[model samples]
Structures are given as structure tokens and as C-alpha cells.
Target: MTRSARRTRRTTRSLQVAGVSAAALLALSACSSSDDASSDSSSTPKSSSSPKLTGTVTVFAAASLKESFTSLGKEFEQAHPGTKVTFNFGGSDTLAASITGGAPADVFAAASPKTMAIVTDKKDAATTPATFVRNQLEIATLPGNPDKVSSLKDLTTSDLKVVLCDKTVPCGAAAQKALDASHLKLTPVSYEQDVKSALTKVELNEADAAVVYKTDVKAAGDKVEGVEFPESADAINDYPIALLKDAPNAEAATAFIALVQSPEGQKVLTAAGFLKPTA
Candidate 1:
């Protein structure tokens, strides 16, 4: 072979070898880059984004839950930027009736299971009701207990002019249970439809005292004095909460219920003179 041809052949072989080496290097670099990307992806945590909550969440709650639930509602609104929490605070039975009667409510928080059953029995609750807190009866008297009402029996004094919640109300039912347990009878000046109304009697000086929840007396602050009795232990009412079946905003309603069952929500309730639920 001619020298020029031999040289050309040698040069072509060298270039081919270099081209293969370059292609191999490129493949190795690409593999390394892919491995690094996979390792980085495996080590990194995915960002958790919660669904945005919006619109109004209407809650029908017992009168006794007014203070604490109101606070929770505000916190819920703040945590969920575009959401609003509206409440219907009233007698548990009335609220239950409203729920069963097709009133648009996102949630229900009742003072007693019996009242909650009024809605649950009709399948109006989206979820099984869970007890969130419990409350016991207390004698609410004028500030400083002006009449010296020291015990449940003291409220029985003919001239004391006590007030009581109506028999249908949880507060009234619990008060009756306590009275029955103590084997003492109380003749109230009037029977109010709800606990707040019954407590109002004492705060406004319309009645000397009233049988109500300790939470209510605490909420009244200096307006009324609280008198605890041993019989009240046997008459504690369990407050239960549930998501309504026909809730306008079921997602937000469920979230609110979750918040109420959370530790932060319990702190608010406990501070309002509510007892932790046993079951």
C-alpha cells in the first residue's frame, strides 16, 4: 500500500476510536445525571397542599356552646381564608327540630345525646355524632349570691323565686335529674325555653336564682354567682357534634368538625368551664 493511503487509513481508525470514546462518555454522563436526578427526587419530600376551603359554613349549636364555639368559628375562618362560619345558637331541641325540618345547616352541636338523636334518628346527620364535651348543672344566682343560695336545696326556698329551663331543654332535663337524685323538689318562678334564657333570669335580677350550666355562669362572668352541688355529678350532659347530611358546604363542615375535635379546639372548650367527654 502507498504511504499516503496507509496514513489516511490510520488517521480514519484513530478518529473512529475517538468518536466511540466520546459517545461512551456522553452516555455515562447522561446516566450519571439521570441517577442524580432520581436520588434527589427520592430524598426530597413532596409539598403537601390542602384543598382551598371557601363559602359559608352554617352551624346549629346549643346555647351553652355560644362562647367557645364562637371563638372556634372565628379561628376556623382565619385558618381558611375564603371561608365564613355562621352559627345558630339556641336550645338543642329547637336546633335539632330545625335540622330535621330541612333548615340548611352544615353542622350540629347539641348539649345532650337525646337532643342529637332527634336529628340522627331521622338520618339527618352525615356522620355519627361524637361527644366533644360534657357539662354539669350549677345554680346561678345574682352576683355575690345575694340570697345566700348555697345549695340546690336553698333554691327551694318558697320566696327565693328561682327559674329553670323547660323540661324539653337539656339544661332543664339535667337539672330535673339532679333534683330527682337528691329527692328534692324545686318550684321555679318560671321555666325558660333554653338555658341562656333561664340564666338570664338571674343576671337581670328577674329571678333570685336559676338552674343552668356551669359554662353559662362562667360566661356571665360577674353577672351571676355559681353554686355547685353534689347531685350535679349524676346529671352531666354530653355535648355531641355531627355533620349534617344536607350541608350546603360539606367539605368545610367536615373540616370544622375536625377542628372542633382537635386539641386546640378542646383548649377553648375547657377554658369555658366545659368538662372533657368521658366517652
Candidate 2:
């Protein structure tokens, strides 16, 4: 218990307390750093999922597919919130003309295989085409069988006053094929640019009977009556879809294509009276 020894012991005790305090501060600092790292990692979104695509997708679909394609477009937008679908639904031939003339489009859905070939031949498609659906000619009459049109041969009965899609149109081509198969010649009073316009003519009571797609007649539902003819089997035109070569929103376009081919899409298409390619 000498004064020098007492002073030395006090200084040693102070050094020990300081060391403990420093160690405790270091432990707290380490814990804070670990929490910060964990917070950062948790805040970050996962990267191993499908990328979110935000852009506009323009589709040039066949005129006959208007109803079904429109339904599919709405479903697509619902599934992908940050996407917009702009559709240019028209005659496949007209669509081909527009696209070949340099119109911008994300995807092309042609009613005819020939028109799709025109697109692919020009290298306008980014991928191989996929046949999505098929359609054939149906006799669309104005509110019941006003013409009592039962068969293809019946169309040429002189008083039927039928309107038909132009030879350039898929429906018209199918009608021609059907007529050719039956060895019957139909001299329609007028040739329409598309099945829709032809159906519209019948719906408006302008034409007695017009040939259009089964899907188109289904969409008309009560506006016109569709009569299935046996000749339809001879001229089924397949619908093909593909991404455009100069697509701006390719990811969305591709997703839209897959969605149309998906079960949900097939259901929509089928419900709208579109026959599946396989079916």
C-alpha cells in the first residue's frame, strides 16, 4: 500500500476500462454494418426473373380476327401493365400492302398463308411463322335465311344477289376454291375488300348473302346468320403470326405472341369462334 503502487494500480484499472469500452463500441459498429448490408440486399429487387418490358406494340392483324384479337389485346395489357397494344386490323392483303410499303409494326397476323409468305419472303419477319388459327367461308345472310341459301351451288341461282370478298382476300379466295371444287361458278354482284366489309354489307341489308369467316359471323351474332356449307371444308385458310423484322418492342411482341398461343389465349380465340390450327 505504498503511494507509487496505489497510483500504478489506479492507472492500470483506467486502461482496462478504456479497452472494454473500445471493444464494446467496435462490436456495435460491426452489428450496425451487418444490418445496413442486409437492408440493402432486401431492398434490391430480384434479377433472376422475366424482365419488365415497357413499350408500345403495334399489331397488324387480319380483319377477320378483329374481335378475337381485340380481346386478346386487352388480356395482354392486363397481364402486362406497362404495355400498350395498337392494332391495325384490316384485310390481310391491305395489311400486306401497308407493311410492304414501309408501315411500322411489331407483329403481323395474316389470314392467308400466301400473304404471310409475302412478308417472310421480304425478310420482314424476325422469326418463323406460326399458324394460329383457320377460317373458312360461311354464307352470311340478313337476319335468317332470307335467301334460303343452303349450298354453294345455291348462290348462283341468279336471284340470290350475293356479295363476295375480292379474289385477293382470303375469304374470297376460299370461296373461289370452294366453288372450283364443286365445279360451280359464283358471279357475285360485288367483291368486297375484306370479310368484315362483306359481312357489314349483309348486316346493313345491302347484300342478300355474302361469304365471310365463321368467326366473323360469330362476332356479328344476331346481326347476321351464318350457314355452314360443306364446300367450306375445301378452302380452309390458315392464319399465321410472326414478329416483324423492324419491331421496336420485340420483347412485348414476343410475349404477346406466346400469350395468344397459350391456353388462355386459345380459349379466347375459340370462344370467339376461331378454329385452332390443330383443331
Candidate 3:
């Protein structure tokens, strides 16, 4: 071959080799970048999946939540070492007012959506409230049902002394709804501030009967007897829960809320006679 042709051929071979080297470097660089991106994506979920919760979580809940929530709080404390759960149980409206008044609560579990709306409307809730459970009204009579109160109408008898929750509270509102649904106009001996108080009147025999939550009657054990009435279905109260907007322990609050919505939490609530929330 001619010398010029040989030189040209060698130059061409050198150029081809340089091109191949450049392409291989680009492929390696792209593969490294792609691997790094995949690794980052996979790790992102691990960091956010489970929150590390610590510190004290203060929860303001409805009076009706006293029993089940206390049990659930203990379970939460047991599951999260170094974390504490403090509770303030009262009427839903009262608790909502307290939260809106800057009570510095970490969470709020209300007995009714209407009461929860008071806080949410004030922008005191961190997230939209979720209905966690339901409750029904029942006639709580003296032990052994001495008055023989079989239904809501039976409470209207002139001789029977009936107590009811005040109109401001969820239980009271439910009781009034049930009464209205049945077209029964019975005057209660006294309108208590909360369901527990109404049930207490029956338990103490101060009132022969009371319209209170089924859960309250159940929690009272042998102190009072529960009589379910069909009208109660119309006044079923939906319980809702939410994390407070200015929570002192946000992580712990979130964890507590998650625990309460879990299957184990449902078991505890249902065992206490609270109806499960229907999806």
C-alpha cells in the first residue's frame, strides 16, 4: 500500500478508537447517575414511612372517650418508650372551645362531627378530622330496670324521674333528636352537662331513668341498665379525631392518632361498647 494511504488508514483507526472511548465513558457516567437516582428514590420512603416519636402528647377528648381512650393511651405509652400520653376528657363542645381558646393540646377526639367542626372552623386542627367511631343513645335506668323502661316512650311516664344531658353536649343533642323522632315530649328532671353525669343520676337512683350513650351505660356496669330504642338510630353520633394545629409534640400526636385508628385501637373501642365507624 502507498505510504500516504497507510498513514490515512492509521489516522482513521485512531479516530475510531477515540470515538469508542468517549461513548464508553458516557455510558458509564449515565449508568452511575441512574444508579444514584434509584438509590435515592428507594431511601426516601424509608425515612418517611415511620416517624420517630418522643415526648409527651396531650389529648383533649370527649367525655364518652374516657374509658377506651384511657386504655388506648396506656397501650400507646407502652409501645413508645420515653413517650407519655396525657388526657383531658370532657364534653365535646367544651373541649372544642378550650382548644380554640389556645389550650395547647396535641390532639382532639370529639364525640360528634358538629363539635369537631367548631375547632376546624377556627383553624385549630392540623388536618381534616376523620370519623373514628359511632355512638347510639340508650335509656339508662336504675339497676334491674325497676321502672320497667323498655323504650324511649316509657321514660315519659309521669311517675318515672328521667334525667338527660344538657342540649349543648353531643349526648344531649342525640337524646333530644331521638325524642323528637319519636314525637315524645318528656321533661327531664335535670339536664346534666355530660353523659356521665346523666348516667350518674340513674346510677345513684336520683333519677329513675336517663337518656345517655349506650357506652356510658355499658361502662357503668351493674350500676345502670341499658334499654335500646329504635329511635336512637336516627341520632347516632359520629366521633371524630384530629391533630391540633399548634401541637407541642407533633410527632407523638401523629403517632397517637395513628394508633387510635389502627385495628388494635378499634378492638379496644368496640370492646367498650362503641360502634365501629362504617366506611
Candidate 4:
């Protein structure tokens, strides 16, 4: 052959080798970039599922929840350092109205689902309310079982001077249901605005008897006597709780709610004579 032909063949071979090296380098660079991207993605922190709670939480609860919820409130504050809890306890219906009226509260706990419905209907609740406890009606009497009040029908006695919660309140509603279930009608001496008021009438001997919650009677201690009637079973009030839609301290409110449904909270409520929510 010829020397020029040999040289041309050598040059082509060298070009081929250079092209292969360049392709290999490109592939290695791409692989390294992909690895670096994956590593960066893995190193990124993920968002937490639960928000960190701080600050104050205002809770609006039923009148009957005064004793139990107050205890739980203290516990919640202890569990969460740098947190404060304030409460407004009143008739369930009244509290519901206050919340719907734009009361700046973080949480709401009602004695009856019907009352809680008022808040839910107005979209004042942040989430679906949950029943945390059950309450039953009882005849609260001036200490020592005076007037011989035995059953729900006994409240109908004309001479007893009985006081009842207005039908608008949960306690009154439950009491009316129990009386209706027993086929009895009673005309109370007065209709109070809340359970505490009705219970107070009996405590002060202003009325011979009042249809109030068992918890109220228990909390009253020696001041009033409690009588349980079978008809109360037909009118059990399911207590529900929820965080408000425009809660000032949303995270703290949520944590407070969880604490109420926790075992420790159940213990405190049961001790105050509230029934456990049925399965």
C-alpha cells in the first residue's frame, strides 16, 4: 500500500478513540448529576403532621362541665408549658348562641348534640364535633330527700314547688324527655336559664326539687340530694366538643380537645358523675 494511506487510517482510529472517551465522560457526568439531585431531595425536611401548640385557649363549655372541665383545664395547662386556659361555662344553648354571634373562643363543649348542631349549622366549628361524654337527668332535692320525691312522676306533685331549666337548655330538654317518656306532665314553679340556676334553687331551699344533671347534684355535695329515675335512660344527653372555625389559638385548642378525650380526662369527668360515651 502507500504511506499516506497508512497515516490516514491511523488518524481515523485516533478520532474513534476520542469520540468513545467523550461519550463515556458524558454518561458519567449525567449519572453524577442524577445522584446529587436524589441526595438533595432526600435531605429536605418533611412537614410535620401536627402543628406545635402554644399560647392561650379559650373554652366555652356547658354549665354542668364546670367542675370537670375546670380540672381538665388545669391539667392541660400543666401538660403544655407556656399555655393558658380560660373558660366560659353556661347553658349549652346560650353558649352556642354566643359562639355563632362571633364570640372569640378557641373551643366549645356542649352538653347536648342538639346545641352543638347550632354551632355546626353556622359553620362556626372547625371540624365535625365529637361526643366526649354522656349526661343523664336527676331530681335534685333540698338535702335529705324531703317531700318524698321518688320517681319522675313525683315532680308533678302540686305542693313540691319544683324548679326546672328552661326547655332551651340541654338539662331542661333531657328532663322534659324523661317526663314525657313516663307519660307525666309537670308545671314547675319557675323555669331557670341554666342547670346551675335550677340546681341553685334547690341548694338554697328556694325550691323543694329541680330536675338537674346528676353531675350537678354530685358537685353540690351535701347541699342537695340526688335521685335517679329509670326514665332518664331514655333521655341521655351526649356531650360534644369542637374547635371554633376562627379559633385564636387553633393548635392549642386542638390539643386541649385531645386532652379531654384522653383516658385521664375521662377519669376526671367520671369522677364528677358524668357517664362514659357509649360505643
Candidate 5:
């Protein structure tokens, strides 16, 4: 153990310690760099997988669907948050025309297959139309049987003022078909533009009888009485529903469509007096 030898040994040991410390610092720096790189990668924007449907949905439906669609619209809003359902209720033909003409619409429910065909032809429909319900003609009169109009044959009487929808509307077309099948032609005082208007005339006691859907009579409550005629079966109009291609919120539109076809929707529609589709 000479002093120089001891000093050299100590100095060599210190150098080794310094080398080890430098290596440890380098290792820590590498690990820190790796963690930062990993953090950046993880934080990088990725395609979101969460499904969120938020927007406005516009529905164009036949005037006949007013009551049923109003309830369904409220239900849809409750089921989907951040969504507003705006309904445009009018004649099926008119609604189809509006939709096909580039009107913004999320869905459409028509009172007749023919009207639905118009949208399908224009490729405005997102999917195949499905029949949800059917409706038949009924003889609606004042609650007290003022006209005593009991049979289809009785409608031909010259004294009774009858109101009928124009051939353009579904009910009117059906009434025409039924009358043609029955070989009975009754003169109507006025050719109403739509079924509701035809029914409204009866409701207001403006006309003695109007050929309208049974559901319309029911929806009118006690304002009018419904007379079921056997010939009505010959002219049942099928109701159809479809999602529009220009839907603003696709997810919500799909969900709403599913809801309408569901059992709950069926029940709601039935409660509104709509008959289930046979097909």
C-alpha cells in the first residue's frame, strides 16, 4: 500500500462510479423520451368510436297521420336527446312532391302506396317503403243520425248532401274505386281537396255524409258518427312509411323508424285507430 498506488486506485474507482452514474442518467433519459413519445401517440387524435346522434329531423307525413305521428314524434324526442322533430303534415301526394322536389325531410309516411311510389321513383327514399296500416271508407254523419243514411244505396238519394274527397287524395281515390266496384254513383255536392277537409264538412254539419277513413271518424270523437258499409272493404288504402335519403341525422332517423315499426309504435298507432297492415 504505497500512497501513490492507493491514490490511483481511489481515483480509478471514482471514474468507474462517474461512468455508472452517466449510464444511469442516459437510461433514465431514454425511458423519459420513450414515455413522452408514447404519451404523444396515445393523445393523438383518433377516429371517434362513440356513437352520438345530435341534430334536427324533419318528417313529412300525410294529413291522415296527424294524430298518430304527433304522439310518435313526442316519443322520438324523449328517446333521443338533443333532437328536434319537425313534422309537415299534408296530403300524401303533396308531401311526396315536396320531398321529391328537394325539400329537406328525414322521413315520410304516406296514406297511399301510390304516393310512396313517387318518392321511390325519384330516389328520395332511403329504403324500401313498409306498409304500417290500412284504412277503409266510412259514412260519417251527425251524431243523431239526422240523415238516417244507413246503407250505401241510401247515399244516392237526391235529398242528402254528400261530400267526397277529390280523386287526388287517397280516400277520394278509394271511395271512387269502391263506388265503381259497387256500381253506385252518388252525386257529391263538393269535391273536397283532402280526406280531413271532407270529414270536416261532416263534422261542422256542412254536409250530410262524407266518405272518410274509419280512423278519421274515430279521431273526430263524438262530433260525428261512423256508419260501416260493406262496400268499404273494396277500397281499403294501405299506409306506408320510409326514411328519406336527405335525412339530416341518419342515426336518429334509423332509430325513429325502428321505433315506429316496433310493438310499442304499433300499439300507439292502433290506439290512434289505425288498422294494422294485412300484408
Candidate 6:
């Protein structure tokens, strides 16, 4: 072969080798970059990208649970940054009616199992009702017991104006049970829709006495005096709580219910005169 032709062939071979090397380097660099990206993605926490508990958790609770549940609602809000707790406190029956009527609610805490059954029977409850606390009836009289009311029987006196919870309400039903157990009859001056209302009548001096839950009388502070009766043991109420089926904020409602049944919640409830649930 001629010298010029040989030189051209060597140069061409050298250029081909350089091109191959460059292509190999580019492939390695791209592979390294892909590996680095994969490692970074795996290192990130999965929970960080998950949706957080947010929005309002609406709870329908018996009037007697007003104080303790309100405190718990605040604690729940503090625990979850972007959450809110709202409550509908009233007669358990009334609350159940509202829930079954398509009212939007996330949770229900009824004063009695019977009242809770009103919702559960209609499949309004997403979960089985669990009794978290129990409440006993008490006679609430004016501060200092001006009427000298000491026992449940004292409220039965016709001369004294006594208020009672309506029969449909847990408080009134418990009171009636206690009365039946004692073989006695009480004719209240008025039948209030809830324990709070019955207690209020005595607090405002509109009535001489009222039969209400121990928790209600305790919540009334110095406005009323509580008298404990032996018959109350037979009529203690079981306060059941449940998650509603059509809950708009089921996630937060579940968390709130957990908080209510937690040890921290029991501390708040027992402090407010609510009896701890029996085994």
C-alpha cells in the first residue's frame, strides 16, 4: 500500500476509537444520574406526601357532655394544626333524630344506650357504640339548699316546684327508673328536654329543685347543690360514643373519638363528676 493511503487509514481508525470512548462515557454518566435520582426518591418519607387530617369534625353529644367534650374538642384542634371541632349539644334523642334526618355530623356521644340505639338501629352509626363513661342522677337544689332538699324524695313534695328531664331523655329516664326502684312517684313542676335545662331551672331559682345528672350539677358550680341518693346506683346511665356513617370528616372524627376514649380523656371526664365505665 502507498504511505499516504496507510497514514489515512491509521487516522481514520484513531478517530473511530475516540468516538466509541466518548459514547461509552456518556452512557456511564447517564446511568449514574439515574441511580442518584432513584436513591433520593427512596430516601424521602412516604407519609410526608400523604394527606393530613384537616377540616371540621362535627360532634353531636348529649347536653351533659358539654363541658368535658368542649375541652376535648379544643385539645383535638391543638393536636391537629389544620383541624376544627364543632359540637351540637342537646338531648340525645334530638341529636339522634337530627343525624337520621340527614343532618351532617361526624360523631355521636349519647347519654344512654337506648338513645344511641335510635341511631344505630337505622344504620346511622358507622361503628358499634362503646360506653366510655357512666353518669348517675342527683338532686340539684338552690345554692345552700334553701329548700332543705336532701334526698330524691324531698323533690317529690308537692309544695316545692321541681323540674325534671323529659321521659325520652336519658336523665329523665334514669330518674324514673330510680323512682320506680324506690316504689315512689314524682310529679315535677315541669319536664325539661335535657339535663342541662332541668339543672338550669334550679340554678335560676325558677324551680326549688331538679333531678339531673351528677355531672350537670357539678358543672353548675356554685349555682346548685348536689344531693346523692342510694337509688342512683340502679339508674346510672351509660354514655356511649360512636362514629356516624355519613361523616363528612371521618378521619378527624375517628381521631376525636380516640381522644375521648383515651386515658387523657378519662381524666377530664372523671374530674367533671362522670363515672368511669365499668368493666
Best by TM-score: 1
| Candidate 5 local lDDT, 140-244, one digit each (tens) | 998877888888888899999899988888888999898999899988999887789998998888999998888888899999999999999889989998998
Q: Model 6, 1-279: lDDT tens per residue?
A: 999999999999999999999999999999999999999999987765656889999999999999999999999999899999999999999999999999999999999999999999999999999999999999998899888877878777889998889999999999999999998898888999998888888888899988898898889999999889999999999999999999999998999999999999999999999999999
Taking all chains together, each candidate's TM-score versus the true structure is: 0.88, 0.83, 0.82, 0.82, 0.80, 0.84
Clashes of 4: 0
> 245 in model 6: Cα distance from truth in Å?
0.7
Q: Model 1 reaches what TM-score against the true structure? A: 0.88
Off by over 4 Å in 6: 1-50
Each prediction's whole-model lDDT (CA)? 0.94, 0.89, 0.91, 0.92, 0.88, 0.93
Question: Which scores greater on TM-score, model 1 or model 2?
Answer: 1
RMSD of each: 4.0, 4.9, 6.9, 7.0, 6.1, 6.1
lDDT, candidate 5, at 7: 100
- Measured by lDDT, the strongest candidate is 1
* Candidate 2: clashing residue pairs, number: 0
Q: Tell me the tens digit of each residue's lDDT in model 2 across 196-227.
A: 88888888888888988898888998998888
| Each candidate's clash count | 0, 0, 0, 0, 0, 0
Instruction: Sort all candidates by lDDT, best to worst.
Output: 1, 6, 4, 3, 2, 5
The regions of model 1 sitting more than 4 angstroms off are: 1-24, 31-48
Model 2 pairs whose backbones collide: none
Task: Tell me the spans in candidate 2 whose CA falls farther than 4 Å from its real position.
Answer: 1-47
Per-residue CA lDDT of model 1 for 123-205, tens digit only, reads: 99989999999998999988887788888999888889999999999999999999998899998889998999998888888
Candidate 4 global CA lDDT score: 0.92
Model 5 bad stretches (over 4 Å): 1-50
lDDT-wise, the better of 1 and 6 is: 1
Q: Which sections of candidate 3 miss by over 4 Å? A: 1-51
